[model samples]
Target: MPINSFISLFGRSPIGPMQQHIAKAHECAANLVPFFEAVMAEDWVKVEQVQQEMARLEREADKLKKSVRLSLPKSLFLPVARTDLLELLSVQDKVANRAKDIAGLMLGRQMAIPQTLHAPMRAYVQRTVDASAQALKAMNELDELLEAGFGGREAALVERLVEELEDIEHDTDVMQIGVRQQLFKLEKDLAPVDVMFLYKIIEWIGDVADRAERVGNRLEQLLAR
Candidate 1:
């Protein structure tokens, strides 16, 4: 909740501040590591700990996002159009938003990950977090892009990072399919409602990666401009 990153979301060139914001957003996604562990262990206490922390992080991201909306168009020297910068910020924020959503829904339902799902589900959650991590890595290059005037070597480097993020997201897709297949095999043993929510959880986990890749896509658009 402390979110020291809020100081720079668009302070000057919009690069440094955006970097900070994504770092915070990615923090929410990264928390899923411990969260899934707690869930698999059926440790509701630990689950709540991670969930509360994520809520704090999401709140911080939301505050910074609102700040960006309120503080723009004054003295900030945005290299890209104001709308483009805001779009990137919005995408980055969704990473945290979805992470929070996954935790909230899972906790509220006291959702249990089937024993058969434990392994693939853990891998799935980690891979999704990895995607968000990659998104943050690409955003970290924004300052360098600004230095190079959004051209030359720095822009290329960011493009490579985005490409890697895409690959991670693709891998996530494959994993989701495999996990669903496993779930289908176990569904007859599970309650109909539980099976439905399990599928939804799987989908929401993938949403984390999907939204993370969208951040990279948004940045690519900025680079094109």
Candidate 2:
């Protein structure tokens, strides 16, 4: 079947708007990899390039978010509550917003990643991105779950995906702690201002994953209802 026909059959699917948000959120999250890479390499040009790209993606996500919100009719009915769907959309948008914040800070400060903290910092970024990806995967299953009426095998599968997202988020938290410790060790050697911004950067990076986990948790709640 043509994809459009298939989509038309499920015209009321909330998954459509949710997936549009997720796609942009994932794009925002994925850009962080190259953003950090450029920062680590001390290549200001490349860093600016990636930062611009992140900003563009963020703008795109914001537009889609507005579109989704405005397009949702007050009388429209679905398998899930409208408020739950709105909450889920809000949480998903946060993921993209946090990514934009990270990129903006990196560009504004041009903060250098210390060699000792590089490995742990990169690990944190990767894990956080992984968590967001896992959350997206769970959101992707929403259509199937709705088709299954939120019961039986499909429900179980989505629950498992949520569990994996939580696990990855926990691991990112650990990675953040280790990275902070390494940063602490180098604090005395670095300028106070640089150290302060570096700490902020670390905190913001972790926020990305934190928000992603919230997305999963919100979805889990929706499933429970």
Candidate 3:
């Protein structure tokens, strides 16, 4: 390649595209709020509509991830380790994947949460989505981290944001416990198979939050390098 062409290719920062990908991931996760609502409303039309949109967003994120990987420079002159950036991208990808999984399984089964569990389950899903949102907020600072060479004030701000993400994850954990307890009390009245899936849905909600926190964890790791 010509020297000018090489410079232009390598000069393009990967940070912006990485941030775009996470925003899409979080958007998919955030849609779960409406998804669960439609399920509670027993509005199959709306539920299917929302799930298709989320699936679309996830696909868009996947395309961006692939583009980032292919265009990312392999040069040692990059600000962050190329491998570390790739790993972070992989973790970020899972947030969308997990969200897609929840939508697919729930929609496929036409699953319904018991009326009594609806309120808490909705709250649980919102908080879980909040985790993904927090991850995105922290990730938006990647350009600043690069500008500051990943240190000092910009780095401290990112650390604090990650800490907030951790706290949100903890709240989701407690909420999960409360939800499971409520479901346990009502399980006998519900179909045994439905109860089983309800428990799995609850666990999967927690997994969304868990994967979001890992995005924060990856940011912290990058700082350590």
Q: Pick the candidate with the highest TM-score.
A: 3
Q: Model 1: runs farther than 4 Å from truth?
A: 1-11, 74-76
User: Model 3 reaches what TM-score against the true structure?
Assistant: 0.94
Evaluate residue 212 in candidate 3 and report its C-alpha lDDT on the 0 to 100 scale.
99
Per-residue lDDT, model 3, residue 111, is 96
Model 3 residue runs over 4 Å out of place are 1-9
Model 3 lDDT tens row, 46-67: 9999999999999999999999
Best first by TM-score, ranked: 3, 2, 1
Report the C-alpha lDDT of model 1 over 47-144, residue by residue, as the tens digit. Answer: 99999999999999888888777767654444567788888999899999999999999899999988988999999999999999999999888776
Indicate the worst ten consecutive residues by lDDT in candidate 1.
1-10
The residue-by-residue lDDT of candidate 2 on 1-225, one tens digit each, is: 433354466555556877988889888888899889888999999989988888888889888888888877664445677778888898988998888998888788888888888788888899999988998999998887877778899999999999999999999889888988898889889999999988888888888898889988987887888
The best-first sequence of candidates by lDDT reads 3, 1, 2
Return the top candidate by lDDT. 3
* Steric clash count of candidate 1: 2
